[model samples]
Target: MRQEPEGYAWSRFGQPEYTNWLDESMSWKETCYIGDWSFLWQHRFTGPDALKLISDFTVNNFEVFDLYQSKHAVHTNKDGKVIHEGVLTRFGDEDFMVHGRGGFWLAYNLEKGNYDASVTNEDWFMYQVSGPNALALLQKLSGSQDLADARYMRAVTITVAGHEIFALRQGMAGEIGFELQGPSSIGAEIYQAVLEAGRDFGIRKMGGRIAMINHLEASFPTIATDYIPAIFDEDMSGYREYFLSSMPPFAKPAYINGSYDGKDISEYYRSPIELGWAKVVTTKRNDYLGAEALAAEKQSPKRVLRTLEWNGDDVLEVQRSLFEPGEHFAYMEMPRDQRGYMWADRVEVDGELVGVATSRGYSYYFRKMLSLATINVDHADVGTEVEVLWGAPGQRQKAIRAVVCPAPYKEDRSRGQLG
Candidate 1:
């Protein structure tokens, strides 16, 4: 939603960009950076039908999902387009927690069926303590020593600030990390305790403005930043009407950008395969909502998400344009897209429309202008050059040079050095 004029969690008591994001980004990799993620919406499902309801709609194989374990659950539409995705944490056979926009999708699914599952919206505050020293800082907290040995995607319950918290073995930044989730009643206390414990480890509380640098470097395609939420098709007009009536304008794709003048909103829908979620799509043992469509789509995918390393010289010139007299392009905001549009800019190869670029931002950690693009498979080869249109629609556009780079452009150390 047009969240706020600032649109970040900078309101936190700790320093936001104490010096600058360039330093914070470096600290986040070399040492540690703590980020507040309490604004992320969460859904709790508890009932005899909880597993049934969730499994019936998602493509993840629950056979591998055990208590305290989690998976990056992907839920697709009837057309195999990704409708919902989140870290699905299983507490029991019937109790579950979903943290992300997928919670809204789960709630919508509840209304469509007569399932016996009960869903609760949780207003928990989440903190991401991550980087090389993340484990060291977490080890300082009470009941959190087990985090040192926690496996990827595992959840551990810890008592901090006299409150029970779930420490999820995850991070968007792709480092050794734990996502601390607990009730809001003790949020301040927990924050204080963690801060006190982290004082010796060179921890920096990252500002909201540069929060998304991790997503770009780690290859996480977000909803608004990456693609429009696939919620507006002819088949989804009912859901669209319901969503538009209840949700804010920023949450709905149709109401937001209107970036591309194309009549079909479906063109913006990204499939699980296209979004680099191929490994999570499984059809063994149970049927999901979009089984047939996903099976068909698995045979071939047109576009795949790739990193666009914007040419250094051209990017330097774009930044220099900010002071020039007249004709300038869409301003390149650092760390993330501050303007908040989906940024459905045109991507062309030899003057032919080949793909679309989204999620343009600067990464001081990478020290390069970066963006995520869903390009045609043929043009997605690493090192292939393509042109990214660098202006808003009807503006003086410039074709900035870019090249296809490997997704997760750097090695992810999240799964390393447990214990």
Candidate 2:
């Protein structure tokens, strides 16, 4: 089994048990899980131009994020395609930790060396406590519920079982969740304390298998899984070396082979707008890496990202009817074929297709088979009819019924008022 960084115990899935805890925590009254976010690159920027530099590189306006507050940010290329997306936390004047998908972010930051920011990829510990009784469980572990009032993306330092850690109210699953970030040295102790405290609340460790499955319902896009990494300009020599040296074994083999427009695999690059990141694109800022290109694309975005629901009966019947029982219906990365650089086209519409269907999974909670795709805006209106082609040429092209719906097909119960 692949062992995670210190403080995380290995699971039968070869991933850490804490990942499984995240999935199990949702159903339980209260549950806690520890994650080794060490693999996520960490950078500290503390200069006059730190905020401005980041603002110029990303789509979100950072001026609005106050100290102790956090918000999601997206880094795009010259084409405004998504390179990296994560939570940007404000620690002080110009100090912050941007957490989430980092492989491309680290490379992009290195390329834009004009800034005074200092980036570091080191070992950091992160844990998540979630569920209906999460606040109470945190209180038991930390000796205080001061964290309960902390709004989403807000961070606060607290002592738990003699260990000091920074707790942030943020989670991928739509639940009352808190992320505990601290030194790797204290990870094991902190993990044990949270698990012990959660015993009475029915918390258990989680694995990545279920976590990947649940991400579809959470509406959180996985970097290489749901979409292709945005690679701007063929001069990726620096990026190639960085990936070879710094990328972790778990995150390596980045490319999803044969998952693009043609079988060649070089035709894939997704912009922020195509990935359903319009809210984060702030035009108020004068300039950024891909601002101009994005602005033009925005006027008439070639493609769009949307959620699609498969006919329930069709999905089940297929599952039961597979003769050879091939790969269990994993998500497809099929691209729309259009004339020139037109965003991926909707299978049903001749309009430009910008995005491809990235994630598709069975929502056990919702009891429906749903998919997330990035297509053209003209085809994005909710209730719009579309067709999903299955199989390859000859034996390929079975049209499946699809409907355009909200990005998050699953209802988020995490934002509700807690007792």
Candidate 3:
């Protein structure tokens, strides 16, 4: 099947860039940005066993899940590999909604499990406004103290554009950001209202091209880009069949490009712990799926997530080969791939394979080519030098020098802590 081209998400609503991507890239940090994410799959689970159903499948401990609070829910297979993960928000005692690809997996389990939960695939428009002035911009529109009172990972309903919407305080840009969500009926209205009201605050409309750069900088490992969903293994054939037949085509048949080519599909699969999401995975609960394995793996994770800064000179040499050499290295797109392909390159230490690098992108703010890599924990310390073998295997390749850094290349300010 033909893969979804790059910029697919952005093109669904508007152009890849309203202003130049370079400027738009800095919006969230310098001023603020408003980006649409209405395409994310959503599912509403309600009934007495709603929390139980979620708790049974996910790694998070809902023992004290507060109303209107959100958790990064990670669902793993029996062997502790992540099948899907998303932001799950508890709206009420028995009502919850989750956003992302995990909805399908949750829905499938709801049908198979002996739970009293009923899930409804709901539609909503999710636009995130984030940055130093993100709250200031929203403050102009809502004029409600509730906006300022909202806590991180918590949702508060406030009126926006004459519509009562749920504003979730969560920042993907690692800044103070609020995700405005409501029925699709008021999507355009609220979207336009935010844009118009944001003019004074210097709100920039983010395009698809630059939207994911924040994800890279913030170290949010995406499903296909950072790691493949754990649904293609032999043990998961049942769910795979269900996923292929029921889920969207783009979510199926995940493709990997660049240097890291492992023989088995499981090689691409990653656990939440490997992705530096250990805090979200609780080992106290043994009832959840993959609890035993996750608990054991959490104690001694073989590989951990880190950032690799590619050598500028060696990276430029690959680009220079295009003009003079008979055989040119693969083209390096600026600011990252727009095609949404998982650029998994191989990371080596002393010419020995130690890790796989994914989500390679260029940060205009940092002016460095960076990628998130899941590598052996022994060599994951900061400033550890490694070589990233760019280009595909069996094809012309370049061993670019790289240095280890923090997974989140940028300082995190998502917790509403502004200086």
Instruction: State how far residue 58 of model 1 sits from its true place (Å).
Output: 1.3
TM-score leaderboard ranking:
3, 1, 2
lDDT tens digits, residue span 343-403, model 1:
6777889888778777777888778888888889999999999988777566766788999
How would you encode candidate 3's per-residue C-alpha lDDT over 212-326 as one tens digit per residue?
7888899999888888888887878888888779755445545668888778778889999999899999988899889999999999899999989999999999889989849
Alpha-carbon lDDT of model 3? 0.87
Cα displacement (angstroms), candidate 2, residue 48, comes to 3.4
Compose the digit string of candidate 2's lDDT tens values, residues 61-177: 765789988878788777676667887787888676777654246436645667766655446677766656677788777876678667777888889878778888876666677
Identify the leading candidate in terms of TM-score. 3
TM accuracy, model 2: 0.81
Indicate which candidate wins on lDDT. 3
Q: Estimate each model's TM-score.
A: 0.91, 0.81, 0.96
Q: Worst lDDT window (10 residues) for model 2?
A: 333-342
Which residue pairs clash in candidate 3?
6-338, 6-339
Report the error of model 2 at residue 83, Å.
Answer: 1.7
Lowest-lDDT window of 10 residues in candidate 3? Answer: 1-10
- Local distance difference test scores for all models: 0.77, 0.61, 0.87
Best-to-worst ranking by lDDT = 3, 1, 2
